[model samples]
Target: MADRRSAGSRSIAIVGPYLSGKTTLLESLLSVTGATTRKGSIKEHNTIGDASAEARDRQMTVEVNSATVEYEGLRWNFLDCPGSIELAQETYNALIGVDAVVVVCEPVVDRVLNLSPLFNFLDEWEIPHLIFLNKMDRADVDFMQVLHALAAVSSRPLIPHQYPIGHGHKLKGFIDLVTEDAFQYHSGACADPIPFPEELQVEEKSARQEMLETLADFDDKLLEELLEDIPPPQDEILQDLKMELGADLIVPVFFGVAEEDYGVRPLMEALLREAPDPSATAERRGLNDADNQPIAQVLKTYYTPQGGKLSLVRVWQGQIEDGMTLNDVRVGGMYRLMGQQHQSVLRAGAGELVALARMDQVKTGDVLTAHAPAPDLPVARMIPQVYAKAIEADNRKDEVKLTSVLGKLLEEDPGLRWEQQGDTHEIVLWGQGDIHLQVALSRLQRKYNLPMTTHQPKIPYRESIRRTTSVHGRYKHQTGGHGQFGDVFLDIQPRERGAGFQFTQKIVGGVVPKQYIPGVEAGVRDYLARGPMGFPVVDIAVTLTNGSYHSVDSSEQAFKQAARIAMQEGMPRCKPVLLEPILNIKIAVPNDFTSKILRLVSGRRGQILGYDAKAAWSGWDEVVAQLPQAEMHDLIVELRSLTLGVGSFEWTYDHLQEVPERFTTQVLQAAWNTK
Candidate 1:
């Protein structure tokens, strides 16, 4: 066993695809380390992770959960991150602060591709990580086949550190490749040493040799020993493993059933022996240890029911005492978190993951320090929102409160975004997917006592004319002693597409007074707000050609009413057409699914521009297209389904295009029905 006492406090993240047993692995780790008296089951809704009501109701991790434990005299902080691809931003944010990561996944080969995005992220950041193939006892495939599947997705080379001793549910033990020792697992107890099975000698030898060869790739001495057929000393092998792992040169693979705690102890042992310590992680993050001034980065933020606000932070350098000031804000309290439980602590040292209470000014991804100013630490880039819903307060009186509450929600989860749509005049909430928005809405209701009604966001549609029309109008109201009299002549014409709206006065001879001319232009704009098609009009120009105004009755208000009458009669005769927003989109997916994506795009009435191999991403292609906004509501949902959840897209507003004549009636009917 390798000693981790000198490493000080360490933080690790449990991350994997949805339903991959990451939470279960976390429960096992806490149990084996004596942090908890017994393991809590996920089905029973008693697990330390996923303790939030939203998570328990859905039986999935909706946010990041933090817990601290003492294993062999070393404090270990574990962050159990949400596994849903939609909530991946939570995992990415937490991963940047951790010293190491344990990527928990199932042994199924087909589902292994779900790990590709995660693997790419980890490798790109050079964050040292290892794989724990969970549910081995239930896996029906060969262990080697599963290993090969996992290797296909990861960019880094994988070396098996342990070989399984049995297949499927009969899995009872594992042979340590480095030590060449076999041990049998006992329920809820430490593994006992067992004689190396002779039947597995050949397979174990191959796996062990393969592991050595990979390690040799980075070690000249190890290479020489392999070339000379001399067995390298065990200590030399362990040191090489630790060095390469810390540098992120290789990914060591291990397997076990986390639910039964079968391989949990060995996994923890490997972490102790091979995982990088905080100092190594800090160096990698470009922190100067000599500066000793307290600096920390917020990994996640929580708005607790009682505490008001809690910022989960990783202390990168120096110690943080309770009530210490950071970034001009005093920390109200400091605590170590175990799920939702907070254990008050007076102080926290470097490498410790602790929650600071009442850090309302701090947000997720913010770098805070007591000193003047330091280089800001890099935070995870927020993923683009793929789904959106127009939300409104059910009570109407809570409208202002809803906006305030949403700001706190966005601070807690950067994945969420909200905007007041300028075009549609609606409050829209955007998120990674429907489920993500559902959780946010649930938070609004449960935490803030604000109920909201949500629906698919309305697309911003505009209308324009197909022809020019000249019209005249006169407003003469004789309701008082001085009769209101105003006359105006206007010319309306469609400009080139995307030319937008323009209004100018072509009046001459002072027939229409300059004072009333402004009113005429304002009335033209007001009519354009809602065209004959029941949508905002665009790409048209209106000119005030000629008009007459009475000195007493023809005021600006009279001219405005006259101009409105002209437009109301002329616009319908000019032949109005509906225009829908088009988005320029780039969809990225594995090349294997390129053909399927093409079909999907065409089915959504999208025009494919072209496709090319995505830069820096092997075997992945980027498809460019222009898609109507009306067809984009559920596009991401279908895209992920077709590409095994690895596909993503970037989109920006292109130009408004005329709605095809064939579908114009349908669009108009839908618009009317909504009214």
Candidate 2:
């Protein structure tokens, strides 16, 4: 057994695809390490990770769960991150701060493809990670097949640290490649050492040779020893595994059934021996020489009903004491979380993940330091939103509270965004997919007690003229005392696209008074906001050719009415056209899905600009296209369905173009009906 007590403290993330038993593995780890007297089960809703009431109710993790455990006199902080792609922001943010990651997965070859996105992230950051092939008892496929399939998506070589002695639910033991020891698993206890099985000698020898060969790539001495038929010592093999794993040169593989607590102890021993120390990770991040002042970076922000606001942060250097000031704001409290519960601590040292209370000014990915200026840290960027909905308060009186509640939600999740559209006058909430927005909406009702109704967001459309026309307007009224009279002649013409609304006066004589001219322009601009197409009008020039006004009765109001009258009559005959918003989009996916994506875009009236390999992304292609905003509401749902959730896209407003004639009637009807 390796002595981790001398290794100091370390933080590791438990991450993988959804339903891969990551939480179960966390529980098994706690139990086997003696950190917990009893292991908790997800089915019982009593796991230490996924501790929030919302998580328990949904039986799914919605945010990052932090917990601390003491094993073999060494302290470990386990950040059990949500596995849902919709909630991956939590995982990405926390992964940057951890020393190493344990990627949990099932033993299904087909399901291994789901790990591509996460594997890409780990490779991009060059983070040291190990794979735990979880649920061994339930797997029915060949173990080597799973390894081969996983290697297709991973850039790093997969080095098997252990091989199973049996197959499927009958799995009984494992052969440790480095120690050359065979062990039989006993439920709820440590595995027992057994003699090497004679029936599996050939397989075990081959696997051990492969593991050694993979490690020998970085160790010329080991390679020379192997070529000379000289068996390396056990200590030397372990040292190579540690060095190669710490440098992220190879991904060591382990197999277990987390639900049964089998193979958990071996996994822990491997981590203690192979996982990198905090200093190694700091050097990898280029922060090895950072000043000794207390500096911390926030990994996730949480708003609990009991604690108010908690900023989950990782201390990169120095020590952070309670009541210390960071970002010029005082820390209200410091705590170590155990699931939903927290224990107050006086101070935390470097490489620890603790929650700082009432640091409301700090946000996710923000770096806070005491006395000294904060450092510029590289954090994960938020994924682009692919689904949106127009939201409104169910109770009209809660309208004022909606903004504040949504602000807090946004603070907790940078991926969740709310914007008040000026043109549509709708409060739009955007997220990764429909389920993501739905979860946010449910939180609004459950956490804040603010019920909201949501519908597909309306596309921002504009109206432009296809022809030109001239019309006259006259406002005359005979009342009790002073009579009101104003007249104007205006010419409306179509300008080039994107020209916007332009107003000028060509009055040769003093027909329209200069004082009234301002009012006429205001009315014309206001009327253009809602033209004959029942949408904002743009790219049209209106000229005040001639007009008349009365000195006493013709005020700004009268001239404004005259301009409104001219627009009401002339715009109807100008041949108005509806224009819908177009978005410039880049859809990234495996090259195999390029044709499928191209068809999806074309079917949505999207025009494909071109395609090329996505930079820095292997085996991936970027399909550039222009898609209508209206067609994008459910695009993510379908895109994920087609590409096994590995596909994603980023989009921006490109331009507005004429709505096709086939869809014009439907869009016009909806616009008029909404008004």
Candidate 3:
């Protein structure tokens, strides 16, 4: 309807569920724009979007891939993000700086629920997005049914911008509802205009009227025209689509087969016409344009093979030049990226996504400016880690190198977290799921040559006594000149749960010297470090009732040895039991899968505390339960499988509970085997 071309640059993210053809869509966009000589296929392992070694090996996207192209005198930066639920952090982080989003999905109604979380995030942030129903050539269900299913999950109204005109397994073309123009698809070429199909005239008219009614909900002029049975002009309808879509009020839906590049060009044209400019995005983000200072935010970070660090950032407000200083760190170099390949650029203006080399002080989610202090821009919060593994270098000499490389790894992917667990005395890595950690471990070996050995993290088990006992110990050694002589009596008992450790003493006059009493407590603490069950001892108390010491040869060291002897003899008699850490977990899942999750918890020896509707989340339930840490290792893996990969949970240490009699032996044997 209008030949208007937008000015400046625009950044859009392609995001959806795994295997929904997001990367395929990116490949088609790059190919149609002539940015690449030819397109790459996922099966052939040559696609530019999933270019990383880890991604190629797994045949999936593990991180965000940035590519730039120019079309119709407008520059567009497309961020192809990971589709797996475990790698959603990469998608969320990249979405923060984008002007709009293209949500790619299949036409299967059963799988449409997978888009709920993505829609929820976009709506919450007020980010404008449109749905591209890819793989229409394989469609087996009615398009209207799929659209209705999508509408059920999204908060915003769904308006069909174009209606598919072919039957199942053969998508011929689509009719543009705004213009009522029909087109036919061709291989690797733009669609050709064709006459309207008389057989489908009624369906096309109804669909067009529905789209107009949805748009009219926002514009009174359109509403009057529709109410008075007067047809709205083509320009007015296009304007309404652009305004409503840009304001995030309505999601316009388009259908196509991305593999055949059928609707790719039309999707690109719609984006060029309907998407908002960078200035509009800046205003929406509250960024001041008149400040004349450069402000940018890091969407991702990378470490090159040559030991170079690159920060991929979006220039939100001002132009950034090579060697410019930001946050006390000078930008070493500036470049635009197409997959892993970098093209040198001297300066990048607002709305451009570029890579800045060697900004060591900057990190993902950090806002950078040319001035002294950078402003704080909102960033996506990392999802809670649901799986963990204890990791160490395969070669002992590589331990220090592993530690150093892991820092780089975490900087590159904030969703990953690592820590030195004090209780278990193991280096543990936590992530969204098993696959997420696997990709990180692969990076360790591929990038840094640091191969790692991983296993389920220890449960941080502890030991506590069930009964009380008093035992005496004495140490008398005579060596020709000076001899060691000391005696002690220890009373050991169990404290209440979570009371921790306690130490006290009662002595008669001059029985045990005051100077040597600390030795007794110190020795007891050392013994508690590894108790009868081969774990740290907790919730226990020790007291020294009476002891005799020789005035000449007695010392703290002698007393310490005597106290150790006492504990070694008395602890076995106290009947110590194994205590496993229990986690208080709150699981979030759609209501349809609530019952299945409850059964899953039961199978894991977890006690269901209660469940209720998750606050502010309709059709979702939050189940509260207490599960042993040992059972938590793979809970996320199964939970996601049961709930279409959208279920998640958050947990904290609840308390230590005694292991069941039946499982105690297995637990102890496993611990011993590891040692």
How close is every model to the real structure, measured as TM-score? 0.98, 0.98, 0.97
- Superposed by TM-score, candidate 3 places the C-alpha of residue 630 at a distance from the truth, in angstroms, of 1.0
Model 3 over residues 11-52: C-alpha lDDT tens digits? 999999989999999999999999987899999998989999
Score candidate 1 by TM-score against the native: 0.98
The candidate that achieves the highest lDDT relative to the unseen native structure: 1
Cα lDDT of candidate 2 equals: 0.88
Whose TM-score is higher: candidate 1's or candidate 3's? 1
What order do you get sorting by TM-score, best first? 1, 2, 3
* Error of model 2, residue 187, in angstroms: 1.4
For 1-675, candidate 1 gives per-residue lDDT tens digits of: 245676678899999999999999999999998999989998999999999999998889999999999888689999999999999998999999998999999989899989988988998889999999998887485899999988888888998989998989789899999999999988788889999999999999999999999999999999999999999999999999999999999999988888888899988998888889888899899998896888899999999999999999999988998998999999999999999999999998889999999887889988989987856788887788889999999998998788789999898889999999887889999998988999999999999998999999998999999999999988889875878888999999999999999998887899998989988988888888898989999999999999898888888888888999999999999999999999999999999999999999999999999999998677789999999999999999999999998899989999999999999999899889988
For all candidates in order, the CA lDDT equals 0.91, 0.88, 0.91
Candidate 3 ranges beyond 4 A from true positions: 1-6
- Candidate 2, pairs of clashing residues: none
**Residue 86 lDDT in model 1?**
91
